[model samples]
Target: MALFGFIGAGNMGLPLMKAAAATFGKNEVIFTDASKERSQFVSDQTGIRFLTDNCSVVKQCKNLVLAVKPQFFPVVLNEIKDVVTKDQIVISIAAGIKIESIKSMLSNSVRIVRAMPNTPAMVLQGMSGICFSEDTFTDEEKEIIDRFFKSFGKYEVFDERLMNAVVCANGSSPAYVYMFIEALADSVVSYGIPRDKAYELAAQTVLGSAALVLETGEHPGKLKDQVCSPGGTTIAAVKALEEYGFRNAIMKATDACYKKCEELSNK
Candidate 1:
C-alpha cells in the first residue's frame, strides 16, 4: 500500500510531503496539485509518483492530505468527493474548516484528522496541533497522525475546540517572531554592526534561546533571570522593554490573532 498522497503541492504541502517522504520512503508517496508543473516538480524532487488528478490520488493512496486553501476547498472537495472511501484517512490542513463540516461533505465513515501546522515545518522545526473525532479516528490512527506530524517537527494532540487557539500560538506567531528578529537586527545595525552580522546574531540568539527552553524545561522567566546579571546591560534592556509595554503588546497581538482565527474558522 502507498504510504501517503497529497492533493496540494504548494509551499506548505510540498514541504510536508518532503518531510513525510524523508521519514517514510519516497516510493510510498503519491501526489498531485492543481498546477501540473508544480505537481511534477515535487514528485521529481522527492521520487514520489505524480498522479494526473486528485481522484487518482484518493483511489490509489490510503492516507490522503487535503492541503488546498480555504477558498479552493469547495472545488477540490467536489472533484474527489466520489473517490474518497470509508477505509481511507483524510487529513485536512485548511484553516478554520471543522472536521464535522468535512465529514458532512464527504462519507460519514471516513477517518478524518484536522491539523494546524506552523510555517517552520518547512525547515523541520514546526509546532503542529492535531485534533481527531471519536467517530473518525481511533487511538492507533491518532498515533499515526502524530508520528506523521512529528516527521517535520514537534506536535501536540489537543481537543478540537483548541485547534483555533493553536492557530494563534504556532501558526500565526511565526510571522510575529520574524518581525521581532528583524526589529532586533535593525536596532543592532543602527549601533554600527553590519546588517548581516546583526541579523545572524539576533537569529542565532532566538534559536538558541528556544532550544534552551525545550532542553532545560525551565520557565522562560527563570531563563530571563539567568541572562540578566545584577545591574547588567540585559537588565537595562529588559527595563526598556517593560517601559515600552512589550509584554502587553505581545499579549494583545496574540489576542488579535486568536480572534481572527475564530472569525476565519466560522468562514
Candidate 2:
C-alpha cells in the first residue's frame, strides 16, 4: 500500500506529494488528479505511480491527503467518505477547512490533521502549522506526522482554533513578502539599476535579513535598531517607511487575509 495517497495534484498538492515521496520513497507515494494529463505529467516527471481516481487512492494508501482546494472539499470528501477507513489518517492542506467540518463531511472516526503550508514548500523550505483533531497522538502517529511536514521544512503543531491565524501568518504571507520584494526591486530599477540586477539585490537582501533573524534569535525590532544609526541612510529610509505607514499597511493586509480565511471557514 502507498504511504500517502494524494487526491489532487495541482500546485500545492504537487510540491507536497514530492515532499512525501522524498521522505518515504517514490514507490510508497501514489496520487491522482482530476486531470489525467496532470497525473501523467507528474508520473513522467517523478516515476511515481498514479491511480485513476480519488476513491481508488483511498483504497490503496495507508494515509490519505485531501489536497484539493477548499471549495471542492465537499464533493471530494463525499466521493471518498464511504471508503475511508479509521485506520487511515486524513491530512488536509486545504486552507480554512476546519477539522470538525471535515469530520462532519466524512466520518467523525476519521483521524484528521489540518495543515497550512505556503508555496515555499515547493523549494522544501516551507513552514507548516499543523492541528490534530485529537488532543494527542500515539508515538508512531506522532512520528508519521512529524516526518510528513518536516519532509518539506519546519512544522509547529497548534490549537485548531489558530489554524486560520496560521493561514494568515505564514500560509498567505509569502505572497505579501513577494509583493514587498517586487516593490523594492521596482524602486531600485527606477534609480537606473538594471531590472534583473535590482531584483537580485532586493531578493538577496530579504533572504539574508530573514536568515540573520533566524540565526541570531534577536528581536526583529532590535535588529532594525542595529541597522539604523544616527544620521544614516538606513535611518532615513526607516523614517520614510514610518511616515508612509509601511508597518500599518502590512498589518492591515494581514487583517484582510485573516478575514478571508474566516469567511472561507464559515462558508
State the C-alpha lDDT per candidate.
0.86, 0.91
Q: What CA RMSD would you report for each candidate?
A: 1.7, 1.1
Q: Write the per-residue lDDT of candidate 2 for residues 1-267, one digit (tens) a residue.
A: 988999998889989999999889998899999999999999999888999999899999988888899999999999898999888889999988898899998888889989998888999989999888984558897898899899998999899999999998899899988999999999988989999999899889998999999999999999999999999999999999999999999899889988998998998
lDDT of 1 by residue, 89-113 (tens): 9989877888887877787787788
Best by lDDT: 2
- The top-ranked prediction according to TM-score is 2
Which portions of model 2 miss their true places by more than 4 Å?
Answer: none
- For residue 183, give model 1's deviation from the true position in Å: 1.0
lDDT of 1: 0.86
